[model samples]
Target chain A: MTASGGPAVRLVTGTVLDADGAPVAGASVHLADGPVPLPDIAALTGPDGRFSFPVGADGVYTVACRTADGRGARAAVAVGPAGAPPVELRPG
Target chain B: MTNGPHTAVSNQPVEITAPAAEQAVFEGPSEGAQGGSPAAFTSDGLEQVAGHTRALSESVPAEAWTAPSAPLPDIGEASFGPPDMLETVHGPDDRVQITDTAAYPWRVNASLLITAADNSQWIGTGWFIGPHTLVTAGHVVHIKHSGVPGRDGWVKSIQVMPGRNGTFLPFGAVTSTNFRSVTGWTADGDENFDYGAIVIPTELGAVTGWFGFGSWPDADLLKTSVNISGYPGDQPPGTQWYDGRGVSSVNPLKVFYDIDTAGGQSGSAVYRIHNGGRYGIAVHAYGGLTTNSGTRITKAVFDNLVLWKA
Candidate 1:
């Protein structure tokens, strides 16, 4: 959340799951926007397969998640002024 | 003159005069396809040749085979900041990218295509240091203990292609009649002494300008910016990638930098521009979590380069 006296920025949370709906730990999640630099936000899913990033503004972003052996998924999310909803990415 | 296989001597001048027909054969586009034949040397023969070469390297003085101690300062950790990702053109921070070698004419011809003996293909970067000589990583041409637990030796055959851009072969590939390396790497697998040379047919270097190699003190290297361009496996097979960064640290025989690299870039030249010319100061090898390393050229290595260039 931003410090200024505006609508508070929310935390973007998500979970990574394998094909069998099992939590996928150690998966890499990368978020990027055209205006933002590459790898603007990168995180590894915790043991519970959950991860989060703080977003201050509203915009479209490309989020990609991949496993150690190069298998994973990607998606485009549109964030509103309020914030974005939780995301669940599953390996194909 | 016959184009048959010729032996190489450590201190003697190597002269190769291929027959006109053989030269024409190498000039063809399909030369790379001429590997598999019953007449080609067997794996056993290749191993014997590698053993002999290893013996020759053993004759060198002991002091020439040294490396920097482990646990290097500030750069010793195996894994650091971001996960080490392998991809084409795009690096972790988008700081590194693929290079169009054609734009850099000097570097275009300086790169090479290395084909090993087992026909197990790999992209090894090399640069010409003389009219008939090329410098590359020793492990590219020969890897001990490469296969089954006990079976290990030199590769049967090796071919070099200069200025190879994807399917475009500006300069055709040529097989090396002679290959040389230091005993420290071939015999002991010392990464810090992983340097080797190839003696190609004469006149090739004249067409493609070569880079001068020298050893500068670690102090001066710390103050200079280094650039490395090579064929990384992550990119389209033969394409070259470029990474430039300041020195992170240096030990007696190795140079460590923050430059990005991948598998096939092992033999790339780690060089700096000086006096309006590019000079290679190390043979790039070893990719780590935070930094990459190379064998720092020393006086003994420089002398060996001169000898190989002969």
Candidate 2:
């Protein structure tokens, strides 16, 4: 799916890290749940282990991430219409 | 757009949808609490047509409706199931991505990125059952609860990408506004009735091929392993993921299984293969820690689907 436009589009961004805090790339990241409809599909971490989702409403959304080999982690963060602060995830 | 004598409803609501702009443009959903008229007929009229259609359909074997373009290679037998599948807890993130998405079966599974009535964008999944017909979770086409006031009605639109591999669209994508669901879901938001359908403006399924679905008996379902493959939001974006396990349990309306999945996979096909033929048993919806479930294909649902296929 293509990205939505307009400068007002707020985003919930973060990076997936290992237990030691090193950036973990290629991990799958998802939102546990959010307002009525979340945008697009889940995010896949880039080489820098970062992922982002476009958000519009305010609520607590879980940034759940998992590695190709089964390691995973999740963080629940409060968000606003403007978006949430960047979160850091560490999969064990 | 009006229909012939067989239907009277106008076509689905459209909003300057290009072949594929995705979420680039936003538009309000069809006005009113009532959704846009169904692609075909109203429930009353559909049932009437189904009466005659069902009689003719029953005579034909399920596989004849739509077979794959050619035989498909084994898309994995799964980590759990009969004879010796080592039935165990299904958590290990073992789902494999399908790069051969241009092939049959895989191509039939479409990734659904949806825009609800509230204009909130979300992700889900869908599968082609006919040249133009798609079966999906009711929630994908219509939002429920939502807490978003009057926006809990039909979705605004859907970007259907069949055989999508990450950003690569082997079959491209189509944005559809036409959709179908029962009163149990649209009116009451009943969890037990969370099944729906979509009809694309084009006959994409004809080239992609489609799956046949039927209401199998409980006894048969218990012995079979249901296969699930869809675009889960947690995975690589737009890529299809798969997992399969034996039916954990079943009721008259729901079929429970151990298929591993997360959000964005709400409408994947829960199918069982018999004699190498794939037929959908359910429309995958709810996902849990240990299990995922779907709306089973019952006789009544079968009839409704037959009519909706038009």
Candidate 3:
């Protein structure tokens, strides 16, 4: 994978929303059965329920999320050098 | 410290072998265990290949060959928190998570779900050193200067899960209260002394295998390729990640590197791979924007590991 400033790397950012289409707060988002990464403790969504992961190469990666109340969702996407669009996760 | 670039990979296993007598292993930290002689520092850490037990049962078909089905009790030490939990990002985060953790090497690293003395939960990494002993960062086991009243001693408990990929725990999890650290770390809270060990009641390591650690000369170490793999909090919960890079710097007490790492990766092994052997050169702890470092394996630290693993 590319380093922090390596031109080959790009960010894949998105948000976690509920069935109501409102941004969910305090959601735990992570790679779907993949390598571990940053964020000192847990990979948590921000106040806006947004989460992000780094895409180093051209491939498909799955991003999954869950809330304390048991709502969960996941998205599998293909990324390229130009980077992919943001993903939306909605757990029933 | 932050890493610029790294040849990051998943938890892919290479050959694991005994130290093939690298004369370098018997070098450096030229001091005796108790102020005796440089000979004291020349000892090699205990390493085992997977499928073999470090301590076997007396009967043929020893229990060591099989895992203990009975659950382990949760034993923990004093308070724990992030007064100094450093996970620096130098650039874009390029960590690769490992889901194929049912194999060698990767299985040695553990996901440390820590229950601090204050009852707050935290996460960190640790690795097997012996059949029943796991090595980790001192702060992971004991909190210091956390600024919380009555929350700076032995943590309450730690659930050690080896080869944990998300929720797929191939080697089932075990909780423990028993731990070991030096006075320098526990009393002084010194960064240089930030290393410790966890002793589980079972010999789970015999199944996962363990790394051999040693203290080599400062000159012999520069630019050596090193590997670091552990559970980072930023990735999926309980997922293991990995990266390999060259040693960036070294002091009498630490070995610095450009390997990409983050928080919760604290206590991961900074190991050197040689002729099929993995030797822990340091116990990873502090992180910087440009370079992350670990408590170097020296005479004092090696002696502690010797005693703790026994």
Candidate 4:
């Protein structure tokens, strides 16, 4: 099925960390199509500072993270339409 | 001296007939009696409103309508840092400042206003949704500390300056004839229900050509692009700004986006273009550094909006 016709099965994973390299729990993580404005998937980092997204029709995707104190960071990863391996994100 | 034309006063009162399911949204004393009752208008307030009206009458021609623009850009795959992260002593560049008003005549329908009540003035943004009805954030019109019954914190009055570009008032300013809000916001302080409306004199919207509002499934809405224009406090007060981006996430009650907004932008219309017409789908309210949120126009909210427009 086409990407829009069904739920996204491609998985992207990452870890969120503070400037000190410590896990930043409760930070918001967003995954969107490459450089495009707006994220298609959003989630909060868990206690272990891990987050994941199931994006559809992924070519290149941007992963962004923002902590409660307003610190933010982002990175870009390329994914296949079928799926991709895990990725890590560190927000300064 | 460019105030358009002096049309006779319609003085037509809008009859709010929200359905029973939506009545709970408007619970509380009538809007006029919320905050210590309406305060007596000061001469300065009256004069300001009059000046605003005259200016609008001269500036907004009767047939003023913004022609449609190109469809929003497609969301492509690329990586960019959050706007806040890019900030340095020099300042942030997330918001694209709009300098040409003629290119965005519809911006005239968005207004920045001060809610004067309890001897304090609070600023917020609002947009025209009908010939006389304006939609804005609920908190813009009323403030309640506890959200308790009979604890209404309604403001005395709201002064709206439409098409305010810095010191210039292209369409003019006016005060609300009435105000309305959802009980979830006024009584419960629920962010999910932070929506409200103001009733203005009919002539203003007639000249501005208000936007239509709608409610669509979140899935379908996610596929479209969204744009918002409003007065941001951080910028020069009264100057409108515009930004458009695809929705980041959406739920039944809220639409999330990365569009940069500031405090004064609450109540700005979060709208999209469909079939060459602009339709509001949410009422912009909250601004987080990473994500800005708006109260989604659900079926219940859409029904209430229809009644308010009627």
Candidate 5:
């Protein structure tokens, strides 16, 4: 709605832990909004820690992750359009 | 030393490097494998599509797009989404740092078109809709008349650029239209009726102004958090936001926003906040929505739509 570079509204979620913290079952969580980028927008986490994406009209996000025994993490969050304010996952 | 075939291809200065999100749905060339002109992949076609994408980026190793196990949900503790952490850490020569702000302003917008066999390129996501109507995703701008089997798409010329690092702001003077299939219709390039409506003469707030469309919200905006902007030509381009969590639900025609969209994001505009206000609908068209394949599944007149002032 204003995404080609700037104007507040960016939402991108994550959560799929393992390696001491627990919570990693049948993972398939993905999110990409740029042309050709893909984690493949997936969702399969329902033991408790949720996953959602109504996505931005706000801005600032750069989140990345790779699990299922791959072990990876990248972080940055700034979603604002009056939403996106809860995300917590610990364990390298 | 050099000044012949236009100074030897302009003294060999080709090193643009800014289009990698996985080819963003392959723009610029390859319209049905052409036999003549349709090979715009200079730099030797990016070195033969980077040697056919280096064995598919070394056998699917974007870390395999992650997910071994992690869908948290245990009582006494709660998790919404996005927490296994890893949001932009590219460094293995993929090189991603991105930090140039004099006025970032959230910046990141996109809308492309050039097809119907006329040198391939269909990437969308630019919905202003009135001010010169510009909505996207009818397969990224109509295209289905070749060999005519069902046909329901055709419009090649609609450019509304804003950002993706090259920092653009002027490019809008093209229009195309087609969206009148509201029956038991099944398949005709069915991207779930992959919506499309661009009638731009000039007025998307003249550049950026207008956003609001809702209906599929019955309850549970899943994870209830959002934000997703488009315009991707990775390696630190302009706009590419993400913070997913709206894992598929509430389906009348379509509504799935795990964020993550490519091919320039079909016709992106999936925001949330409903009830109190703050809507921004038009959730990911064709970039992702494969519950089936015969897409065109429409039915939401809602009085021609224009609601978002509550």
Candidate 6:
């Protein structure tokens, strides 16, 4: 369930990894099973292989990196509500 | 390029070229017949609530060929390896044809193909790793068509179609026993580690050539060149898929090049060129930013020393 009545917006940050452990930068991060990537939400990992997204709703959402191109980590992470911790994706 | 903090290199941007899309997909079959376009998949396509996701497919019309180079400036032509013997277009029934060696030459009997969990819809791509082991992009197996959520979006079923060209082989089918995401991908969601390997139950027919793996961390300093090959939809109509090559970018973190890639080109192998040996390092995943009117970026294998090997 999502935390209502709160003014705080949801913040999600995570590092995408491949089967082996490494930082995958410049990967395309999208909200899985939810809103469209373009307007709804989307981000690319920084040089340090990090990404962050703002969320306002709560549900069983999937975060995916569509292609493992320059970015090596191709994973699907789950994001919760405002008070929840960011989901971690383990590429296999 | 020497492997070091990318910032330490001369800030001057090197003259890199992107492979032209027109020339790459020219002689090959239609993209539609290959797979659906990831660039075109829209938000409306993901509107489904929860159910078996629809399989996305697209055709590559011969007319869609854009010519020697793509309309983009930085784009170049697809690189080729040894001369190939592919020459058939659509098969007799208008379906794709299949051949081993000469008429339909391939290094191995197995051509890597991936499928969704439900198996309602399917897409195909070729792999050139181990005989019983096949490789593909993590996204290919993880993301379903309908935007539906599974038990953690894990793939329920995956089949490898070796010697497949729209026809089933007499040896029967090969099912994957175990699937493992390469370690680099498990650690990061970047282009450097976008590869995954699957262990097949048996050998994929008459296995021809097997690519050997090399270590990236062990690679020498300075610019390193590599050859990339796959069924990029650019081979002549009826012949089996041909191969292409590119001088691997000398840059670190962002290894850009002008290789011929399309929807089905994902998971193709990127080889390190060293003393006449083709050492497999990374797998092809996606196109990069456009550099010239015809050039584009390609994501290849990285983190060889780190990827979880079978």
Question: Model 4: per-residue lDDT, tens digit, B154-256?
Answer: 6567777766776677666788747777666655555566777877765566555566677788677765667777766445545667666566677768887
Q: Ten residues in a row with the worst lDDT in model 6 chain A?
A: A33-42
Off by over 4 Å in 6: A1-92, B1-105, B118-120, B124-128, B144-146, B163-172, B182-188, B216-225, B232-240, B248-254, B291-310
Candidate number with greatest lDDT: 2
Residue by residue across B85-157, what tens digits does model 5's lDDT show?
Answer: 2222121222122222111222223444333333232334555533454445544544432222332234335
TM-score of chain B of 4: 0.69
Cα-based lDDT at residue B75, candidate 2: 17
- DockQ (0 to 1) for model 3: 0.09
DockQ head-to-head 2 vs 3, winner? 2
Best by DockQ: 2
Clashes of each: 0, 1, 23, 15, 86, 85
lDDT of each structure?
Answer: 0.54, 0.63, 0.62, 0.56, 0.35, 0.36
> Which regions of candidate 3 deviate over 4 angstroms?
A1-92, B1-87
| Candidates by TM-score, descending order | 2, 3, 1, 4, 6, 5
lDDT of 2 by residue, B1-310 (tens): 1111112121255421212212211111111122222222222211111212212322467567431121111111122212121111244554656666776667788988776665555678898877788888877887655534554678888899988988888778999988877766766555566778888999888777777788788888875767777887666567777666567677778787766677678788898765445678888876432345688888656655665665
Higher-scoring candidate on TM-score, 1 or 3:
3
- Candidate 2 to truth, TM: 0.62
Candidate maximizing TM-score: 2
lDDT of 1 by residue, B1-310 (tens): 3211111122124543222321110000111211221111122221111112222222357488332233352342232323233222233532234443433323323444443443333346777776687777766655543422222345445566676676566666777747777666665555556777777866566555566677788778876667676765444545656666556678887787666665456677787766545567888765532456787777666656666676
* Per-residue lDDT of model 6, residues B262-302, tens digit only: 33444555554343334455555544322100101122232
**On lDDT, who's better, 1 or 5?**
1
Estimate the TM-score of every prediction: 0.56, 0.62, 0.60, 0.55, 0.27, 0.43
